[model samples]
Target chain A: MSGASVLYDVPGPKAKVRNRIYSVLGALAVLALIGFIVLRLSANGDFDPARWDIFNYAGVRNSIRDGVLATLQVFAIAAVLSLAVGVLLAVARLSDHRPVRWLATGFIELFRSIPLLITIYAIWVLLLNNRTELGLSDNQPQFWALVIGLTVYNGSVQAEVLRAGILSVPKGQREAAYALGMRKTQVMTTVLIPQAVRAMLPTIISQLVVTLKDTSLGYIITYEELLYSTRLLAGNTTVGGENPYVQVIIVTGAIYIAMCLALSALANWIERRGRRAKTGIGVVEAGDVGNAGALTAAVAAEAAADTTADTAN
Target chain B: MNVLLDYLPEFRAGFLGTLAITAASAVIALVLGVLIAGFRVSPIPPLRAFGTAWVTLLRNTPLTLLFLIAFFVVPKILFQGASPFVLGMLALGLYTSSFVCEAIRSGISTVPVGQAEAARSIGLSFTQTLRLIVLPQATRTVLPPLSSIFIALTKNSAVAGAFSVTELFGYAKLLSDKGYAIAVIFLWVALAYLLITFAISGVFRLLERRMGVAR
Candidate 1:
């Protein structure tokens, strides 16, 4: 059987009849649930065009556009800063010195365990309280607070991601680098990290997508990001005759989904490109010459087993 | 320290509230996740498509947006009299279920195909095969990732505080508003979270040691 068929079997005649009955019942159940939800929502005027028409207003459009821009700005700054911090922490965790490694591990664990919202709230309050002493300008503290909280939390996560990637690299590569008289940092930057990055690129990019979505947490602190602005827009009666809370939320949620999907698409493209590049550790054919036939035989045996399994199904 | 003692009742309430929310949402998420995973691996094409769509849609949206929808829209449409606690629970549960489904699906994939094939050959129904032969094996492999999801659920419960749910962060905010030090209050809150999460990690680690399959 193909991989897809492994989890189930092709039904016999009797079983097919039973499965058909099950299929119909299941589909009807799902449809009934959908219909009930739709009827209820319609009863509440949630589907009314007037509520959704707020999107057409110029002021509402501008506010949404500004919110999108602000959200993107925060995401971009946080993404870059977090990646930088992640690298620093990963290096620190991998340091030969015990204290450095412990310190890095402690920081990552502490922030990782804390909720991103609390971090942002704490930072926002801290900055507001110390704004005069710190010489921070108005309106910038919120932005900084969001960015810093994201940086610290996501940086800790990315550090673990990078550390895992680095660890997955073969120890032989690092030994080879040292054998060539390279220093520890040089070995890391040149040999291990480069390969580690290629291996973990998909994970890194996915975490970045996560970071993008997480920018919404700024709403809790009234940072005027996409979700926060949606709330404000929903409350503004001038935009639409109704509250438009449902409509604004749906639109904002769709925008977030669009952004995250785009990031995921990019991650997929890069993953495919990386696969095609095949920049993994090259095998040393010279040393493995004698075992080549054995290796090929092992592969042949595995293929035969797969074919047998397929035929059995 | 004196300030923390003064607000001991608030702190206790907040801690318990956070725990209750996390437990409720975690249970909801686990149930939804298992069903979604079943749909994902089902033979029926429509079921697979529906499962995929649900996971993709829910996963892409932020938890905060989910909460907004739950708070502002869902109650109006579905549960008119539900409290913010219920709304928060629904949002977090729905949002986290996607990740849980993904984890469970991956675990299901790790179960060797031959095992399922064997069960099917012995006249087991698809659901029977999953329950009897597949899920037990998948559960063992899934424990680690499942624990991580719950840990995340614990932290994400903090967002409910934003909706005035009186969770730990909410209590912290209340104290800060009443002339307490912001940094100190936050520090205590963070420490509380750390304690809970670390305890969770310890439990999972012990479970892993006891039940994990040696590769």
Candidate 2:
């Protein structure tokens, strides 16, 4: 049979046999590794039915459910706020004023470079230290700390995504908007940003998926997120006489995977819809922008042609 | 400031520990990523399926969950006497390898099909073509993204602190517990991370400038 690879021709008789031997050896090697892992795990009783029994308990299930809810709550707040921050920063970075652009750039770079775990931890500590002065109520500080940390980090990432999207728009669109006598803000808000957002929606949503996963960092600050609750459940003997560490981890990890995959699937769906809509300026027919003089000359020639066509009509 | 000055030695040790963990895990992740990338592009259906499944599962799951599993389950089931440091490295390495695999696979795709076709027409096997002709070109395209992934790996080493692996953040936690100002301790920790990450980015930028091919 012919191979699917465009790079390679169909294997001849002896080559086919050699390829078959290689494939079998590779498959056997992978299988042997898996078998070794399973055997070792079973020897240590990791697969014992009793070890998994705790997950069947009502209390354990409820705790896990509550953990999932808490995780979602943090994620929801962070996701919305981060998008808002991202837009603000991206706009600021693109500002006409030099100072505004520099400040926004600095903020994004600083947060992006630092470890997210440290950011959340620091915010949690600060909030805890200032709890009385700030008049924060009833463990709200942990929630805010997680949300804020996530907002800062992911917001910076989203800003870059949005900026790239905006930059990718054909320069003619911007010139057209300007020719319509629109202000910079008006052009940005009404024309450029909307199209940019549509173009980059897939990236924005995937970043949200990342934001969802990063919520687990709250566990370090002792926030009762899903990972923290799993740790608690695994360590507590009341759930079961034995530590159901493996079982709890499996269940919690599966929940995370399900959520992230759902987000990604949604992103794909939206991307397909956006492609179908195709609602923007068509691809630039002109060649590369080249130098400023060339671009201005092209625009001038197009403007003259437009005027002549208008007069003839 | 006094607290920082007094704990400078501890902070130094922690910084070194963070670097060590990041370096070790990065090496492991790179090797694993190459193998996984090969699997992903292999002719065998099972290998491709396994590679896809591994990347999807690992990439979607929270790194924290992986760390917890490493700390709690792995030692009990796999390596009975391993240190938290080793477990932390294992978790970080495994989690980051998925991202690295993606970077590598995408890099591989960027290498023109014609190059591979030429190699194959010259009687090179798939492995030989990939190793000799494809990967070297792919590396040029892959370096920028690969560097970012490693930068991410470095920042993620902070998670090890939670598992009691006395990296930078762990040391900050210790100082905070010892009556140092919590805000100051963490600010310093964050600054240290910023320095390291910036250095990594700067080095990568230099490497890219020197080695990158103009498209």
Candidate 3:
């Protein structure tokens, strides 16, 4: 068969044999690696039926369920809170007031440059130090710490994403809104933000996925989140003279992956819808703005474009 | 605060630890990423499937979960287990490698079909075409994103602290437990991280400008 690929030519007889050999070898290598892991774990009694039986317990199932609920709780609170913080920071950074702009920039830069694990740890520590003064219960500190830490770091990131979206809008639209005698705030609310939010919906939702994944960080501060719960259960229970860590970790990891994948699927759907919608401005594939590094590149690119436009004018 | 000043040597060690983790993990991420990108683009269906599975599963799972697996689970399977330092490196490198793989694949796609066709017409094999005609150009596009990934990696190295790796975050954690002023400890810790992050972005930015590819 003739090949249509630009990368490779249609295989001749020898090439066909070689390709088949490569396919078999590659599959074997992959399967062998996986098989080795399973065999090793099996030798270690990790896959023992007794070890797996932990999940069959009602209390164990409830813990897993509670873990899911807690993870979702943190995600829900962080998602809404981060979005709100994001909008505030984005608008403030773009403000005409120099002080506000600088402050916003400083806040975003500080939290972003620091690793979020550190931020969350710091907040958790602070809460512990001030638990009595704040009138908080013992458990409240970790929950608030994780929430606030995620809010600050993710909010800064979302601000940059939102700013990029707003900047992607053509100057003519903003000017048109202004020419209609709308105030700056009115023009922003009516003309810019709605379009920016729509254009950036996918990026925004993807950030929420990051938030969801980051909730596992709550495990660090001993928050009774999903990861924390699963870990606690694993550490507390033992079968066949070994903790069910392998079974527990794998199961919980699957739960986290499923939740994130569902959210990512949602992001893809929104992006597809945005593309097909009658909007002239194509959002294109800004899909991976999920990471700080990617978002930084985007905001920097946006800044670069604005400067070039200014230079051209 | 004198907390940072007093523990200058310890802080320096911690800083070096963070750098060590970042550098080692970065090497892993880059190498694994390139190989996986090759897999994704390869003609072998199994290779492509493996590549897809690697990225999807690794990228979606939390890095914290990865640390748990790296520490508790991988040990049982791999047997004898390495030090936490090595485990932390593996976890961080493996996690970041997924992002790196996606970046490289996207970079490869931007190399344009015409270039590959031209290479094929000139009798270049797929590997040679990718190496000679495609990847050289793709590097320009790939650098900016890779910079950010590295910067992100620098920040992420802090996570190693939680797992007993004693990087900057762990050092800060240690100090906090010692009853130092939290603000003082964090201020120093923050500065150390900012230094690393700025150095990464600056180097990448300079390289990007030298290459003259802002995007």
Candidate with maximal TM-score? 3
The weakest ten consecutive residues by lDDT in model 2 chain A span A285-294
Which scores higher on TM-score, 2 or 3?
Answer: 3
Off by over 4 Å in 1: A1-4, A238-241, A281-313, B213-215
**lDDT head-to-head 1 vs 3, winner:** 3
Count of backbone collisions in candidate 2: 0
Show how many residue pairs clash in every candidate, following the order shown: 1, 0, 0
Global fold similarity of model 3 (TM-score): 0.94
Q: What's the lDDT of the predicted structure labeled candidate 1?
A: 0.79
Ranking by lDDT: 3, 1, 2
Error of 3 at A300 (Å): 6.9
Cα lDDT, model 2, residue B176 = 80
Question: Each prediction's TM-score against the native?
Answer: 0.91, 0.90, 0.94
DockQ of 1: 0.44
lDDT of 1 by residue, A1-313 (tens): 2544676777779868877887787778778878987888888787887777777889899999999999999999999999999999989999999999999999987887788888888888889989999889967889999999999988887777667567667778889899999998899899878876676566677778788988999888888888888788788753334587877887898899999999888777766676566458322111111111212234322322221111110
Q: Which candidate's DockQ is highest?
A: 3
Compared with the true structure, what per-residue lDDT tens digits does model 1 show for residues B160-200? 99898879989988887787888788888988888787787
Quote the lDDT for B133 in model 1: 95
The residue pairs found clashing in candidate 3 are none
TM-score of 2: 0.90
